[model samples]
Target: HAAFRAGLVVCPLSPLYKQNELSYALKKANVKALLLPGCESKQSSINDFHGVFQKSELDEIKKNLKHLILIDGNNSIPNFQGFEVHFFDKLLENDGNLSEEAKNSVTSDDPAALFFTSGTTGKPKGALISHYHMSNNMKFALAKGLSLNGPVSVPLPLFHAFAGIGASVYPIKHYRPIVLNNFWFNIKSTVESIVKYNCVEFWGVPTMVFNLCEYIEATNTKIDSLQKILMGGSPVYESLIKKVKRLIPSIKELSIAYGSTEFGSFVTQTGINDSEEIALKTVGQVADHVSLKIVDPITKKIVKIGEQGEIWVKGYCRMLGYYEDEEKTREVIDQSGWYNMGDLGVLDENGYLKIIGRTKEMIIRGGINLFPKEIEDVINTHPNVAEAYVCGVPSEKLGEEVCAW
Candidate 1:
């Protein structure tokens, strides 16, 4: 938050990243300094928390590194040898006052953050977002009827936009208390925090919600403070919602958010007062000032209402572009400013969007198109089947064969 207010473009790195992954992001972003957690006790060292800095590949880069700011470190800070190292607290203790001129120089158009994609298909692509982009998105969420207030608990990591932007930005904008989850998501700890802090609004992904429900059921714990819950990042099964409702009746509203890092945060979300049928059937109506259209993926033409096609979005919250990747940027954002989402969806006449699947994930079998979502849905209906995933494999006879897991 300090970095943001100070007009510095913050790029948060996920702790789950390995040496190579971390190195790629650092070099790609041309990072000058890295703020990381350091060992607080004599028995432990930051070597485990910051294994990327120890990599031999960073030897040359270390010389050019401006500062190695260590957070949570004791009086003795490790010397990176070449680079200037400082304890996090010492920097705060000697923090210089900022002039009015510096604060006024910042503008909404200025780049505020660089968030990388999940890299599920390839190397992560950095998406540069401006201050106006995020602030407007937060306002859009609030105006779209998301009842967010009071203390909120966010269990997601800072690297993800859901936590970094949705959880952080809105709370700060509204002057509400925001509680950060542990580095590792633990059900017991998460539940205890909610009870301790009396958090009314909560944000989570499907897995986190699932684990919390399991823990609550096993321990028979009741939480009366929880009022609203937002879940996303993956498919939110109806069973999961039912389980949560059954375990904790205090929750008055449960909504789902659909978005990506490229869009700043949430592009669409279920309304707080929306019926269970509408909330369960769709990703909810598109947010205000956001234009959405369904087009045939191959033809690039608008599809009939209720027909499954590629989803396209145009709005104020869209990222400026993929950082330093103009070629890839042009592939998604066209001349008219509409971003081809690359996901399959069907828009009802009422403007609600039902995400079907991804165009890239479609399978061609014997010259017929088959969507894995269709197969997976059928497979998941089995009483014994907990969950199912369907993919396509090359086949000489059928061109492609369906593989289920």
Candidate 2:
């Protein structure tokens, strides 16, 4: 809130990042001040916490980072050369007396945050988003039936948009409280928090949901307050959804949403009152004010209904651009304002979107087109299988051989 009011662009770093990953983001973003976790535990040791700046390749990170505000400090200041290290409480006690001119200087066009995409293939790209984009995105979220009326439990990391906006921004917008899980997801603690806090809504990925289901059934922990479960970040299997429903019959909705960092979190979400078939089979209709197109990746032409193609999005929720990387930005987003989501999906006659797989992840074996999702979906249905990931391996004659784990 303070950062938004001050018009400072927020770049939330993942706590799981090692020194190399941390250094790359800090240097790339040119961060001047950093907020560190005050409580040190097995997850984040004292040396591990301080080693990020100490081991950075850029000298400016050590020299220019002026403030190190501790999130849970006890009024004790840390010593650093040319730095004003202080507890977050101390800064909160100070009064903000911004001049009228300074207050009015910031506009809707100003960048509010720089969220980095998980760069499994290469270095992470920071997506610069404006204040206008975030505000409208939240508004669209509310209109799409996201429950903001009661306490919500979110185990997803805050660095990612799923928990960042849903757990932090959305609650503040609606004057509600949000319950956060541990630095990393712990099945027991997450379920306990829901029962303890009476969280009316919960959100997580498919794996987390599977874990929760296993835990709940094993221990029979009852969370009567839980009314909805928002699932995203990857495709969810029908079997997993059915298991969750059977395990927790009290849950009225298991919404399936589709989104990415480039599109400001949620682009499509299943309705709260949607049937089990609609909720389980497809990522329900696209959000209002957002336009979706399924176009052939090679020709860039729209595909027929139910035919798989690259998904393109044109909406107010789209990111401004990849921060400091116009070359990369132009590669994905075109001049016509359509951002090509590299994932392949089909739009049903009812406008429901069904994600097939990534364009790059598709495999052609013996001239036969194969999607990993199709293979993964089949593998996931086995009773013994918890989840499945299918990939392609090089083959002498087939070109690619399907592999599963």
Candidate 3:
């Protein structure tokens, strides 16, 4: 919030990132200043950041980085050569206010935040999100029923785009109070917080929701306050959906969202009024001001409804581009502004999207394309099977063989 008020772009890095990953991200983003936690809590310590500064790969970062602001630190700060160290609290105590001209200089189109992709495909790429993109995304979510009804519980890490933009930014923009969990997710603590705060809305990944439901079922805990849920960052299977509805009878809305970091978190989400079947099978319809199409990856042509193809989206929520990587940006975004989502899916007659699988993760066996999600879905139906993962392995006769675990 202070960064935005001062018209500076904010880039949040995951605390779990190793030294190499941290150095790479900082140098790649050309970070000029770094603000991180000091030796204040069990989650973080000043020694955790020593590796980042010691790495030789941070030559670029060392050159550009000028301020090393620690959230809570003593005066006995280590002398980082060529860097100025300051305590965050002491800086806040000073009355150095930004002028109106400085605040107003930041326009809606200007980059407000930089979020990195999860690097599941390869190396992480930074995506620049504009003020307009985030603001409109919040508006779209609110219009779809994620509003100021009650306190929202955010158990997911704030560094991720889903939690940062959807769970945090949206609530702040809409004046919705939020209950934030500082440390990693714990089922007991999460449940306690929700019940203690009477949180009505919950945001998390499908795995988190599944664990919460499992804990609730085992303990016979009743959380009557939770009314709305938004789960994303991965596929939401039917089994999980059934568990949620059965375990949490008070939940009036169980929305499943689908989007990428480049799309400012959520592009399509299930509505509160959607039927049980729709909620279980699809990722709902596209958000307002967004255009979606199914494109044949080979021919680069639009496919008919119900035909499986790559998903392409264009809208106000699209990121300006990958930060400082125009070559990679051009590879994903086309001339017409449509961004290739890189996920294979089918659009139903009713315009609902059902994600098939990632294009890169598709298995080819003896010239036949196989989506692992389909096999995993079938396996998960067995009463004994809790979960399953399917992949392709090299085969002598066939090009590839289906491997499951």
Candidate 4:
């Protein structure tokens, strides 16, 4: 909190490519400087642009951009064009040099963060989130609290909303956060981070958990500090839940939370603090102040509770409609302020939501999610696999399965 106030928003990334994108994205959002890694990948780009002096870079910026600050992670600094590059180790040392402007420049509604959404549509959507969104996201997530009482650990990326807001902002709200600049998209690294951080709450895809189950059994290493694990972005398995319960009694609860970038987080399974049924039964009832209704996708008719229908939600947290696309925004957000989630679910008699399926090309097979679009996307990377259309074929046992043809 104070560091942000002090004008040094730390980007502790070592991977040059990802952190470079973060630096550029921040600049695109009007951030004056960058703390880029000094490693081969990032440093080479900086030195290549000797003519591209930091001031010249700012002068050339079409947006209201200003300066460039690079923090060299690998301890090599050439002082290119008197650019603002600091050795990575300097952050750990205190020079008593806080700037005045860094504290004064930001406002509540100013664009503070930018991220790319793996949109179901062909193009990935560049999400421009403001200070308000970041603040509110932290407020929403901190409500979930840490699984372990002493501290919380997150393995998600700082660039992603889950890790950026959930892991970073929320912790800043109350504690000294330990942020790892590394990306945790794979199983092995993700487990290592969790165990190393002694993370109480590890948030990621179910496939991550599926893989962790394999890692745990293979290593026979107990993740003791990982007391409580929460699964989102995809579904968790009963078999997986059984594994968590068997392994970590301190897990207290393996809360299954349902949320999205569009709607901010609206629902969460009750923590160990709540009834045991909160964890076992279903994704806990649509969160407070959140209005949820199931509608027939074709007719748009509101279905009765316990009946399956498309889930539509209207709440304070919904995005201010998509940034500049009114027509696209209208497609989901209706005049009534309800947002069609493209999700199919049922409201139990008791009101807990049971997500059944998605309405769009998005596929959540059994518990494994496969957006044919995303997969076709990866397959298209292969020059031979020209065009692809992945669809879900009905599976009697597993709810639904993926079939790409």
Candidate 5:
């Protein structure tokens, strides 16, 4: 309702949580023309239009949106929505028709999507990302690196860059269907999805894999078909790798990935077909397309290998910077265009990065300088434990104390 009054249309690229919330919020705000991205489920109840954008109050409220598009990054959107579904061929490239001008100018560097810096502590920085970055990341992660031949699981929302490129665009580029049905996955469902689709890969947070490990052990189901699983969003526990090796013996590889919405997966754990050590001990080798450096934050000097320092990345895969905030972009991107990732690590003797800890995740506990991952790693090594999340908490005597949860 508000967007309508303000002459703005919101094309939401989100899951059910955002869809219903935005629907109610937009009505309260007098906004409209929301292109929601899911099928109605028990959680997100049905509107009469069969899970696609229904032409009703939801559609009537907005006045400015030229088009209402449904983007189920997971491909779970039902086919019965009254409106015609517009995919890459229909929208991005013009189905079966291309002008010579369009052909010549259509480069990967063309406008792809828009995102903003979290800007939690400062003004929001919106960045216009290019197809070149998104597509290349998607192509390599999916078809080449992950060896995905069929549908992939995408629980992450498309508003985030990883799902947008890795799950949605990359699979679509190859004319593959995303396994959109059966949205949420627990241990049972995850195993079922792998068996049902003969799914070779799954991409999600490490915690998710940890949960799945718990699930399968409890259920005692066979999940030998799944090939590689990418644990990217957060740090992976070494114990989880040991669990995967024990339970899913057919898994050809286990990749501990470290990436973010800004840059694609820059480091990969190859040669780690069975060794969980590579994942826990190092962050893997840099991608062919990425160049990395460890610099001393205080002296601004590039440190030697095997030395801990602030990590900087330079590559085509890197983002241009915060969209509209020059000052913030200047803070992260160096004068030479290399991005200071705000992370601290060392490239060890074998060229694998051991993340000492984030420059921020470290805490001065009684002046001892503590890192949670170390304690957590020890706890995770326990034969009975599954995973752990470590952080610092307030302490009157020590200034702060490491809390392992």
Candidate 6:
């Protein structure tokens, strides 16, 4: 909120990131100031940076980084050599005012935030998200019927796009209260917080939601206040959906969404009134003001309806290219403004999308194409199977063989 008010591009970094990852992101984005925890645990980020970077690398980072703003007031400030160190509270003591020139200088098209992709397949790329993208995406979410009944519980980390923009920014934009879990997700703490705060909506990834439901079923915990749950960040299997509905009968809506950091927020989401089968199988219809088309990965042509192909998105939700990486950006986004989603999926005639698997993760065995997600979905249906993952392994006879675990 402070960054937005000040018209600064805020880049929220994950606390779990190590020094090398941190250095790369900081340097990549040319970050001028950094605000992080001062000291709460023995292995604080401040203390952990002691010997992680070489002197040359540290010197290069310090050139652009001007300030190290520590959040904790009680703890003594750590010496960040060659950089100006300041306490967060001390900066807040000044009069909160923005100059008219500063206010007018920031335009809606200007970058407002830099979110790094998860880098599952390669090194992380900093996504430049503009103010218009963030505001427009949230407005679409509200129009699509995201519940604002009461306080929303967010157990997922705020660094990721699913939790950061979807769970946090959406509520803040609508003037709704949010109950955010500061620490890592714990089933007991999540349930206690929801019940204690009377939170009507909850947001998390599929794994977190599954564990919460598992714990609730095991302990017979009842959270009557939780009426809606929005799960994403990964594929939500049918078994998990059934388990959630069976364990938490009070839940009125269980929505599954699909999106990425580049899109700023979810481009597709199931509605509260959607049928059980739609909620369990598809990721609902595409959001308003957005264009969705599935294309053949090789042909670069739109596939017939209900055929499987790579997903492509184009709209206000798309990011303003990657931060200073035009080569990589050009590879995904085309001249027509369509951004290749990299994931393979099938769009039914109803416009509902079913994700097949990542394009890079596809396996071709002796002229046969196999999708890991398709195989894993079947394996996950077994009663004894908690989770399943499928990958390709080198084969002597065949080009590649499917391997499941």
Q: Write the per-residue lDDT of candidate 4 for residues 273-347, one digit (tens) a residue.
A: 645455544666665556888998789999987887788987655665554457777888899989888787778
| Candidate 1 per-residue C-alpha lDDT over 107-134 given as tens digits, one digit per residue, 9 for 90 to 100 | 9988788999988778899988888887
Q: Poorest 10 consecutive residues of model 5 by lDDT? A: 1-10
Tens digit of lDDT per residue, candidate 6, span 252-296?
A: 888888888998668788887788888767888998999999998
By descending lDDT, how would the candidates be arranged?
A: 3, 6, 2, 1, 5, 4
lDDT of each: 0.81, 0.82, 0.84, 0.60, 0.61, 0.82
After superposition, candidate 3 runs with Cα above 4 Å error: 45-47, 50-58, 73-75, 146-148
TM-score of each: 0.95, 0.93, 0.95, 0.68, 0.74, 0.95
The alpha-carbon deviation from the true structure for residue 351 of candidate 1, after best TM-score superposition, in angstroms, is 1.1
Model 1 earns a TM-score of 0.95
TM-score of 6: 0.95
Global fold similarity of model 2 (TM-score) = 0.93
lDDT of 3 at 242: 84
**What 10-residue stretch in candidate 6 is worst by lDDT?**
47-56
RMSD score of candidate 4 (Å): 8.1
**Per-residue accuracy of model 3 over 310-351 as CA lDDT, tens digit each:** 999999999999998999999999999999998999999998
Off by over 4 Å in 6: 39-56
Task: Enumerate residue pairs that collide in model 1.
Answer: none
- Pairs that collide, model 4: 34-69, 38-73
TM-score-best of 1 and 2: 1
Q: Which residue pairs come into collision in candidate 2?
A: none
19-101 in candidate 5: lDDT tens per residue?
44434433443332344444433434422222423423545444433334453444454453334444322354544454576
Tell me, by lDDT, which candidate is best: 3
Ranking 2 against 5 by lDDT, winner: 2
Steric clashes per prediction: 0, 0, 0, 2, 13, 0
Clashing pairs in 3: none
Model 2 poorest 10 in a row by lDDT: 39-48
State the local distance difference test value for candidate 2: 0.82
